[model samples]
Target: MQETVLFVDDEKSYLAYTTSIFENKGLRILTASSAMEALEIIDQEHVSVVVSDNEMPGMRGLELLAKIKELSPHTVKIMMTGSADLSTALAAINSGEVFRFVVKPWKKSEMLRAVKDGIRRHRILQSLAREDEYILHSLAQTIELKDASTRGHCDRVATLALKIAAELHISVDRQREIKYGSWLHDCGKIGVPEAILNAERALTPKEFDVIKKHTIWGCDVVRKANLSKTVQDIVLYHHERWDGKGYPCGLKGEDTPLEAQIVAVADVCDALTMDRPYRKGLCRDEFLRTIVEMQGTNLAPHLVDTLLQILERD
Candidate 1:
């Protein structure tokens, strides 16, 4: 699909001339005469770039740019103004957060170059977002490898969570969140000492307390990294229980984010069914029975049902 660009200006001649310059670029161009009209177009179209004149009738260029940033943060913003004042340029850069600024009486070539650069910057931001997600997944795998008994555990939980999310009919974006949450659910273990983590025997009170710190530690790690609120919530609350008996925050019932709760159930199921260094894996029937028993007490009841259905289909 051709990328859509929204150009906002109150001047009819300027709008016509500017629109004509990019008409042959194969872009879906939308023009608005006012800031309010521009906002309406943005709401109605998938605008990838927003170009606004610095001086408009109702709303100044900077004001319209700020509103565009608020409405569509991912869209690249460009400010075009007749004023060449230093303060105006600085305010446009700082307040509007424009990707490019073009002065009025712009050469067609310069304006075109600015638009091209804005598109390039937008692509770079998207690539960076993907890289961030890749790095987070790589770290999750590293966390899983820290414990021999839990090797590949995170991957399995993530897979199961995605399946459960599908059964629950979540949006594709939400399913991605569930997958990331499941993979990083145990990331807090990075802060725990290896001895306690790999201990053959049961943990003492102090060791158990230290182990429990992983949830909070993971939450802090993700928070500091500035991950999306949904992913951060999952990492923080994956250890919480339905009966209010689990983990750092003790968030019970619906207080726990639904994606986190789903991950918790998947993680427990995988842990029970997979063989560990210290114990053999449970038989399928026994595993199913155990999870069924924990439904309302330990796991979210709806998620538990979905999980069993997933297993049945498999």
Candidate 2:
């Protein structure tokens, strides 16, 4: 999304003047007559930078910016007032609410410089986020290349899991974490021998033990990266069953984190639907029947029902 700025000032003349200066400069501007109005716009739109006049009626600039810090913490805030009070400026800076303070009758060059600097800060943050996503997707594709597995296994799992998470009414932040977990659920397989991963025959008892250790290895890998705990849980526990017979950790029932449980169902669904070296993939009708019978045994019963709701809808 492009970086956008909002101007909140009680005086119509100043609001117009602030917006006019940035016109034809590739800057998108939104204006509000009061602090409350500014907040309403913020709630509905993505405002990258907010320049507000402090002495407004109803809600003041500092109070509105404080609320913005809680609501959209990354948005850059600038305090504008005709009077220059060091105390107010200091308070805004110390609280980490305002990025810059501008005096009234400001030089056009000074305001422009401040706004551009704020935009640069926002762009840096956005670029880092994109880089993180690229690294995750690249890592997932590399993992898939190790074994003769389904095409884009991690991507499919993430798509399916996110649909179920949405159906479960999970919060948006958690949904993002779920996506990350889905992509790296089997990351531990990086340590497993390729020969064991591609074996046509059922794994021997000792071989299965090595396979089970992949979860531990993957969790350790994720932990070292300092990822969120939710990501670690999904990597560590995606194989865990609803019954007390999973692996590494035989967590039963709700003992498994919800994010892990969602990814677990998604992983199994993909494995059954896609062709493997040992067996042909199941048709939709057959797969549905088998998984229906598997509810409460191999997977969480409620989560299985949730998955069914998403699949049937699609």
Candidate 3:
């Protein structure tokens, strides 16, 4: 396959120098002296990797990377800067805008290696996106096998979530995202020890902390899988509460992604109504009562109402 890398820098000399270095490397190289020019090229070509300079005039590399993320999420972004700083690096990484950070005066071999690795990562992402639906469904089921008490939990959640999404009248694409996210929401639990998951006794604070880390672990699991953003959001934030008392990020109210908020409601309801080693499943009446009590606190208020309406009709 032909791999095309786009290098964006305001300095014409830097662009020319890098172009010369990689000219005979058997890879297609495209250069842009500004962010706008780079975007134009991107619109016309299928770029594999984008290596951008952070301190460009008009549009900073970080800003351009953000736009590229929105424009072509599959394109791998790499940030290269002469004036490297911790803040910039953290921002790029936390936002998931850049795949790699390279200093401006990087070694020729090291830069080449990073670009090659970025291309490989991009290819992996594309391949995962093309994975058959059954394969992904199987992976979700395999994740559930790690916890015996929760067999079919993901499937139930996906069904319930899809219902809620439809009731909410969201787009079909969003509905699909909700379903995919529900199925893979607890995939991070694979990182938790079986003993901890199956413990009938109360969990110690340390043990609970370990369990909470499952969301992060789950995010890491799907990070390389190239799942859609909505799926990722649900997997990472499904445990977050609406009133700001949740784990990981403690996002409050509408600050949490709507998809995550919807999944949180479905997840808790499913868990409450399903059998567990620690407790028996809540009956329908008990489940409804418990959810009503939890509304506006642990779960989204509107979603609670929506779920109630759904159950009432069912």
Candidate 4:
């Protein structure tokens, strides 16, 4: 519950001034006069919020905050500068690199409020992330009970999707979102009835119509849970075919989100390996052949190739 804020600036006066303002506010205040020095401090301690000056020598504040993102993604970033530019501020906020952009000659009230908001945001995000871990698996488990055949399907799909994402060199944060998305891609199926889901015979078009509504329902569930857009997209769009022939929406190739495409490939890979009431599971070689053939048809070709390369290496 102890919150720490690091202030980075080139001027010793600004560092002292900021520290004086917050020292008695019941918050831990740490300061560094240069961007390099701030990074050193960050490397050794947990920083809850970072208030950085933009014009520091050797490394700019925006660049430093970018590094902070890699070092501690949950840390809130605030950019302060004397020479505030519209373009830089807009881009940083848009890209989620900066939580607040404060002018150097900020009023005491402004600085205090910005830091307060930053801390609150950081706490909320951290709390949600912590709590959502159980929520995701609980939902996945409940979804699995709809059909005994899919007991561990979500975990298997998530593992394969993560591997494909890694092969594509995705950033750590994005990969985390991909993992969440993969785990809940079929979450909407929770709304479907067990009779249809566990049917021994092939599905009728009307029954399939009821089945396809899972994406729509699943997306709604994720949205209400306050998940990232990346997670919601995967849940809704993973069922979309690469050529646009498959799905509730019939989204065409490349039109679908990349994360969704990656999961779709993973879904097919795992689904083919699992025995259904109607058909036996495919052998590894047969599965590989089927995936290769599905390239650019039912699944994205690039992701399919990425999965193939990963499999080959293993």
Q: Quick one: ranking by lDDT, best first?
A: 4, 2, 3, 1
TM-score of each: 0.67, 0.65, 0.61, 0.71
Error of 3 at 108 (Å): 44
Question: Compared with the true structure, what per-residue lDDT tens digits does model 4 show for residues 1-314?
Answer: 68889999998898889999997788999999888888777766678899998988899999999988765667899999775475797689999889988986888999999999999998997897878878898889888988999899999999999999788866556677788888899999988988889898999999999999999999999999878778889999998998889887899998898888889999999999999977889999999888889998998888888988888898
Q: Is candidate 2 or candidate 4 better by TM-score?
A: 4
- Evaluated with TM-score, which candidate comes out highest? 4
| Of candidates 3 and 2, the better by TM-score | 2
Model 2: which residue pairs collide?
none
Worst 10 residues of 2 by lDDT: 67-76
Q: Local error of candidate 2 at 246, Å?
A: 0.5
What is the TM-score (0 to 1) of candidate 1?
0.67
The C-alpha lDDT values of all candidates are 0.82, 0.86, 0.86, 0.87
Q: What digit string (tens of lDDT, one per residue) describes model 1 on residues 1-314?
A: 68778888888887899889998898888899999999877655557788888777778878888776644556799988776554786776775478778888788998889888887877786678689779988998898777888988888998889988878766555676677778788899999998888887778999999988888898888878866567778888888899999987888899998888988988899989988766778999999899999998889998898888888989
The whole-model C-alpha lDDT of candidate 3 against the native structure comes to: 0.86
Residue-wise C-alpha lDDT for candidate 3, range 1-314, written one tens digit per residue:
88889999888888888898898787899999999998877756678899998987899998898887754667899999765475786777887878888886878887889898998998997787557456778988998887889999988988988889888876554676687788889889888999999999889999999999999999887777877777788899999998899989999999999989988988998999999999999998898889999999999899999999999999
Index of the highest-lDDT prediction: 4
